[model samples]
Target: DTAVSQTPKYLVTQMGNDKSIKCEQNLGHDTMYWYKQDSKKFLKIMFSYNNKELIINETVPNRFSPKSPDKAHLNLHINSLELGDSAVYFCASSQQGSETQYFGPGTRLLVL
Candidate 1:
């Protein structure tokens, strides 16, 4: 079984459109994170949730929002998407204090 999973593995949409990606973890982890990998393959953390509480939030635009309904799910909502938002969005989860993170198959987004 997959430890982490994301919906809509590929997304293609026009600029200014709104989209959302859903993430879930079956590893029973306490912490979950959202990461974005740009075309250059630079991966950066966008947000982190621990036990359903927002812990770490990076300097991403206000258009990007992370919502966690529980400890096992973290969903990302992007509004007014721009070309710059075209990237691979990855969802990961790990134990609260562990360094190991299980990542889901990335959601490739294309904003034209």
Candidate 2:
């Protein structure tokens, strides 16, 4: 069984557009997170939610929003996309009080 999954492995869009990527987990984890890896291969945390409660917020733009329907699902919505937004978005999940995490394949976003 897949522990974590994200939709639309590849995405291409023009500037000023809006898009969304969905994530789901089946590992019965309580904490889900969104991470962005830039072209330089630097990983940074965008947001994290545990039990549907917002817990971590990094230096992300206002146009980016993270929504969690439940503990097993976390989705990201991006608006007014810009070239700077082009990056690999990864979804991850972890158990409560656990340091280990499982990551999804990742969604590649390209703003043309």
Candidate 3:
């Protein structure tokens, strides 16, 4: 069984559209996170949830929202997606306070 999984591994959409990606982990971790990797390969954290409580990075835009239905699941929603939002989105999970994280294969989003 996959430790971490994401649906719709590939996403292609036009600008001004809305999209969502879902993630789940079977590792029974207490914390889950969302990260974005830009075209230049720069990776950054967008949002994180610890025990279903949200902790979003200040740099993340309001257009991006992360919802965690439970400790083992996290979903990302993007509204009015822009060209700049084109990037690879990755879901990760780890034990609370742990530095090491296990990442899902990632969802590639292309906004034209």
**Residues 5-27, model 3: lDDT tens digits:** 99889999999999999999999
Superposed Cα RMSD, model 1: 0.5
In model 1, which residue pairs have backbone atoms overlapping below 3 Å? none
lDDT of every predicted structure (CA atoms): 0.97, 0.96, 0.93
Candidate 3's C-alpha lDDT?
0.93
**Stronger candidate by lDDT (1 vs 3):** 1
Model 1 CA deviation exceeding 4 Å by range: none
lDDT by residue (1-112, candidate 2, tens digit) is 8789999899999999999999999999999999999999999999999999999999899999999988999999999999999999999999989999999999999999
In candidate 2, list every pair of residues with a backbone clash.
none
Cα TM-score of candidate 1: 0.98
lDDT, residue 93, model 2? 97
> Model 1, range 1-112, lDDT digits (tens) per residue?
9889999999999999999999999999999999999999999999999999999999999999899999999999999999999999999999987999999999999999
Clashes of each: 0, 0, 0
RMSD of 2: 0.5
Q: Comparing candidate 1 with candidate 3, which one achieves the higher TM-score?
A: 1
